[model samples]
Target chain A: MTIIPFPARSPRRYGDLVVTQPMALEDEADDVRSLAERLVAGEEAALEAVYDRWSPLVHTYALRALADPHDAEDVTQQVFVAAWRSRHTLTPSPSALPAWLIGIARHKVADVRAARARDADRLAAVVSLPGAHELHQSADEDVAEQLVVRQAVDEMPDPRRTILFLAFWEEHSHAEIAERVGLPLGTVKSHLRRGLITLHRQLEGVRHESR
Target chain B: MSHAEPDQLAGLALDPDDASEAVREHAQTCPECAALVAAFTGTRRRAGADALVAPPAHVRDRVLADVRAPAPPTAPPPVVVRERRGVPAWLAAVAAALALVAGIGLGRIGTGETPAPEASDPTPVETDDGGEVVAATALTALDSDAERGEASVTDRDDVITLRVRARDLGDEDGFHEVWLINVDGKRMVGVGILADGDDGEFKVPRHLIDDGYRIVDISVEPDDGDPTHSGVSLARGELA
Candidate 1:
């Protein structure tokens, strides 16, 4: 079977959380595009709309990047406030606002780290922070792309969804998955191939979108 | 752009070292393909790399207040065109036009009537090249409301094919088979056996559809020499 765990996963399922609704990612893409348009058109309420939909994402991402919860919250606030202030000039695609916000988040994160490094006392505090020195610029860049990916996978329908979960998260071999899911080995391989392609398209779509 | 196919890009991303020489050469030469390969590499690395955490609610109130409170009053706000998600301006015109004619308006004709031709398949990840979907149905597990998979009837040229996608049907000692049962419930035709994965295509005769065999079923059949349906259905659906 050609179902090699593409990125070489951790061989661990995050949690057995139940997905109550299986949504169409296309519908979501359309909705996000509209929200982006609204934000660009200077709708103040649209910012709240954007927040209701994605505040948690930005907050969690910021929190992950900055060791301090308060720093993360500050970054999240700056990112949205900056997005609103620059609404007139912003031209990110409908499917791309998340990526754009992420772009802003990255900058805010860098600024926070930079400011901390510039001050010796704060630098001492930073040195004492948990896993602060372990942070790398490359992993920070990957935050948005990873969130987009996890969202797409969660939104994926069954069979393919379950198959991908097994291969990536659970690190199951084709033979093991075939036996476990009672599918033919070939079908599992096909599912993986198709699922991977769909994911590539989603990622490409976000990157290539001009507005 | 002289870009490669999605399958090839995916193949390269999935196993870059194993990619063909031609794919590698093209990727090296074409900027778009190279970028896509890079993007795919990133995608793979990012897919489920970590679980996301939602922030607490107190942050929401603070973030909202910070943006609106600090208003620079010196420069007046620019004239902004608001585009809300509510009813469109043209919708009012269309409604008025519909009211004028006591009958159905021409504008109302194609609004919800026809499914548009797609530039590409958005989801479902299935690879069916050119066959047009004639009829489709969702299969549910037998004796329960749980969805199993979907089946679609497609017509390419003059041939009609039945595509069944079954999921998590659970392993049984007996084989899982596909069948088309007529409405009367007595008459049925054994179409084909379901393979593993999501899709199974069985080319059915044209007359069978016209004869009212609209019910698609996947049943568990025993290894016993009985040529009949084992009477235990794993999943079934009606193609409307």
Candidate 2:
């Protein structure tokens, strides 16, 4: 089992704790991008390769975002379709492949949300599922607690939040993040620096507020 | 690369001996710098925790299904031609004379009274119709008047085939060709040329398809070969 740590990169005055290295999940982003390019090229093998690589993650995200197994499955399918159709524009730069995919997933989630909006009762039913929002929030919390410093992260603007997610969630290097997000490396670093400061303040604020 | 360059020290761990003279002195007394050093020491820990969750299985099938769909038929009916098998000797001679006269008469248009050669030839070029037919079978049905079209998940294996057809591609020499797109219509890759009355086969890389994909399309192209497919879709289809 993976061990998630408490988010304190540098605690001022507490019992010292040794930090462990982060986990390496998979090289899914590049794999997905290459497969997407091939699939767009009309190569049958590309599709199969992509399916094998990221289906699990896609399904998980779909389930979490849509809160319906059937809808999750449908969204997963649509994500690939959107990826295939948009392959030409898919330059696997800063975001890498997985980040790009998550972006696609975000859009698909919005679409599912919009479609569900038409039916207030259905929307309410979806919202009423057992710990639905809590589940979603918890999963993110789990990831944050395990890998990223979430409370600090929650303080940034959308661009910074998005960029950081692409960097951390997708494990893209600074250069990779800059390229994928279409920003200069310097700009990316500045964002990171500012974001880190903001996150620190936010975390401290939460502690203060709670106290 | 084992040691972090000074410039790379934004958030990475730092080796003690490599610490600057001032930082080393600070570590000996000042608790703050010492703590920073310790924090830097364990920077690698962050790398392990940042992975996203995995997607489920069915997404894979849907993506591959869409990627393997074939190009749609977009051409007009084939032109008909008269048979030229057997004839009587006199009739043959008369036909030859008429042909000579027609040829001579047409020559006048080209400075020597020579008739211009007939532009349309009724011969069909050899193509992989079997593969194309299989591809067509995978698509949603086509309307009788549709000129350009696509088929989804027609056939698959390591390679997927898409069959594309066009009635009369006007000045298609430099046109942007065929492309396969993901569902969002943002990610895309070029497949091949959109030749008139011919099928275009796209080779999807096995890795990409394994994850998933959705739409396939063919378009009339101008010779200015940018990899971007002009949205002028001659044909399109969704994978089942």
Candidate 3:
């Protein structure tokens, strides 16, 4: 007689899945909500666990948005602390935790902007791509187009462009993007608008010349 | 060139498919809209690529560690442990022998019965990192009401007490302790151990109050008697 052996159950009973219950990416929203509750209750380990899972993404979003390594580091730390402090308001929902983090970073970016005025001018110098003067100097009209485009992107205000990057590249939803950048939901949409429009205007001469 | 409105262009910037249909249809009939759409689409495509950056791991760790540190516990005490008594003579003798076997065990456990250390006042330690000495400032604490929820502090002439509500402590070894460090940079001492709970109190050292020190550092420490900072700071306070 042939006998079928039942799979052994995991000692931790999280749910029906006997072995380690793996959270699909889709389930991350729920996971984050639960983690938030634990964090609100002063569970340091829970906060640490949440941080380990999501900080990399937050760091990357901040690094790209703020466009400075040091600023990104500061912003990432601020984002986690802010999340912990405000965790009590977290409502369990379908939105992923990363989205919430992105929101927190948004406000943090604004705080950084308000705190560091000197850094903005410094960032403008480095972040601004070669401009019309450089194009005129190089005397390579073909190269000038690319330079012009870069200059246009660089001209975008700190963090508006950063917000765009987080939304467009990171694929964060509007609410997520809004929270991370510290803009009102409507304002976030406007920045995306203004940024895209400004870039188009800057690149118009290049596009016309190229065609 | 007459192209899409900036707001419409904004929508197109996000959803290229929608732009492809709406703007292209308009562009086919109108030359100006076509130029505007191309310019907008090209620019949007270009700017989207520069949005990626990765931070170093060590930097990430440092910032995150600072953030994860808990706010200082306030309110009433939550934990209490009295010396367990009524053990038989043989067992008590065995315990005493075991303490002797482990050289520092008895003194540490005996002291454990007393209140843990009080909070550390911020001493101006010239902390040098990478050859640059930074005026290391450790403030006793700031407790935003929203951050602390229901925690509060009770202060008398010599003893400082704190009450706190804590969560998620299952099968965890050791209690949280309160520590006091001198602001004058002369002393850093542990005044008493604090129990974790929704309503518990910690008794601080009177001498620490006598000295001009008024900062509190609370940490979750293991029962092990190692006198080193575990780097796990939870809550903090300062003398007003």
Candidate 4:
């Protein structure tokens, strides 16, 4: 598994947005390439390792795109199965596996949307339909935002990461998080403040870099 | 109203209940502060959304199983040969022994009323004994639940044992059950009920762990007479 190195600097203001450097993209790409090579070689354990590393990301993308947990789960399954079946076709290089997986995910998501549209059309013949193009664009944007946030969270340091996960992912109150993690309330509050700034900065930096 | 600092805006975004009147008024009037608040709120909302969930363990299992299924004769044979060559005989034997032990342990736990023996030293300190630590993971909270824990799998003379340490798991009306779930999530073996303390150990069948039952799950099961999982998992971690 690829270990992501944390950034050294604190969050810095970039005009209206606070910004920090995101994780090393180059290292991440290399990690993906290595995993894909092992997978393509038919190493069964590689499949499990890849799933452990990327399932959360894939599941999150599907959930955001489909807006239904069941559909998201189905799409996520389809994506991995398709990727594994077509592993031979993928280039054994950095970014290939993730790109291939994401491509498969996009198709699965599109299929779900099309199916839903057809069902809606049949159910209500007179209902005005929204533009599929707009929907797809928005879904892509949402997944992109989620990816940025996930990367930011994944890159956070220990206690901060745990605290932020409890706050944002678990939606726990400050007091609840402190009690659960056995930290003082004031410390939890401080971590929350710093963590949010770091996350915001990381998100802005990713958006900026992608642009 | 004065402008709110980023931290104040973040606090407001995380919990409106924590918002002071000054922060609310500042956010209402200051566009920058409002945008900051909106950004924080958006990140928090997205994080809490179901997107962060892992796919049911079975999905990976099924996908891999399908991929590994025998292909038509026309397919290349090198892949199969490579897979066969990858496993050493010694490792395979060890894996098989672990599976057998796990199976026996499950039966003992299921039928017997006695709790699985607790290690006098709860820490995963490696002993000079033949048992070795195979894998470990820090259990993370799922579905915004506040449970936190760690789990380790040990290979003791071909028998596999699971040691778990959990915290912040407040009293549940139902009992807490530990399970070694297959990657596909379709198959699971009940290791044992979690003791009311911070640390506990359960013997796991090697087959359960070897056959893709790598996810360690601790769930709150209602005493509803049903033996199956209540689906109210408090903490889960996949073995590395």
| Top TM-score prediction, candidate number | 1
- Native contact fraction, candidates in order: 0.30, 0.18, 0.21, 0.34
Error of 4 at A42 (Å): 4.2
Any runs in candidate 2 off by more than 4 Å, and if so which?
A: A1-40, A121-211, B1-56, B69-240
Off by over 4 Å in 4: A1-33, A40-42, A67-70, A88-100, A119-130, A147-157, A166-211, B1-47, B70-240
Worst lDDT window (10 residues) for model 3 chain B? B75-84
What's the C-alpha lDDT at position B164 in model 3?
A: 37
Tens digit per residue, CA lDDT, model 4, A1-211: 1111111112222321211113121224326566777778655566666788777778888887877989988888878766666667766754455556666777888798778878775435323445656767676867756675765677577899889888888778888999998999988988887788777765565454334
Best by DockQ: 4
Of the candidates numbered 1 and 3, which has the greater TM-score value? 1
CAPRI verdict (incorrect, acceptable, medium, high) for model 2:
incorrect
Q: How many pairs in model 4 have backbone atoms within 3 A of each other, for residues 3 or more apart or on separate chains, i.e. clashes? A: 11
lDDT of 2 by residue, A39-144 (tens): 4443345545555555555666667666798887887788776666565555543223444555576667768776876566777776668786566555643332
Candidate 3 Cα errors over 4 Å, as ranges: A1-30, A118-211, B1-54, B67-240
lDDT of 4 by residue, B25-85 (tens): 8898889999999988776655643335678887777777766764433333222311122
The TM-scores, one per candidate, come to: 0.47, 0.33, 0.30, 0.38
Relative to the real complex, the DockQ score for model 4 comes to: 0.14
**lDDT on C-alpha atoms for all candidate structures:** 0.64, 0.45, 0.49, 0.64
